[model samples]
Target: MARYDVPAENHDRVLELLRQLAEASRAEPGNLAFDIFEDIDDPTRIVLLERYVSRDAFAAHRETDHFRDLVLGQIVPLLTSRTVEQLDAEDQ
Candidate 1:
């Protein structure tokens, strides 16, 4: 699984774009799960949870053209900061 902690002042503006990304991601072949959450304490903060069948799936997503355009062209500009974490599931 990979997690993203994102803090932004413009969450409202990106909601539509994020929705699009979520829809696209969910339809991908190797996607196991994908979600978005907002912090109750701070609406500006969002959490992104993504799971894949394997690391190869994650890598494939990174290389996709949509992922690059969304991050580099859309979401990156709207974010104040983004922290990412990758984890290995012990049971898997």
Candidate 2:
């Protein structure tokens, strides 16, 4: 999961970039899901939910061209802050 606090001036551009990122990420081999959400109370806040088949798959995702170009190169620079966390599902 990832959370981004975008500057007001950059919010729209950030959202556009995120849409492209989600599209590319979802097409990756081990990607299970790539979802984007907006914070209702805070229009500048964006959240991403990313899922993969395995740890290695997640690592590979970080190494993708689209990830580097769109996320690191473009979207990241428009944000005031960014946070990422790794999560796992509890066994039933």
TM-score of each: 0.84, 0.95
What tens digits encode model 1's per-residue C-alpha lDDT throughout 29-61? 988877888778877777778888888998887
For all predictions, the C-alpha RMSD in Å is 2.4, 1.2
Candidate 1 residue-pair clash tally? 0
Model 1 misplaced stretches (Cα beyond 4 Å): 1-9
Tens digit of per-residue lDDT, candidate 2, span 1-92: 99999989999899899999999999999999999999999989999999999989999999999999999999998899999998884548
Candidate 1 local lDDT, residue 88: 61
Report the number of the highest-TM-score candidate.
2
For residue 17, what is the lDDT in candidate 1? 69
Clashes of each: 0, 0
Query: Which candidate number would show the highest lDDT if scored against the true structure?
Result: 2
Q: lDDT scores for all predictions?
A: 0.73, 0.92
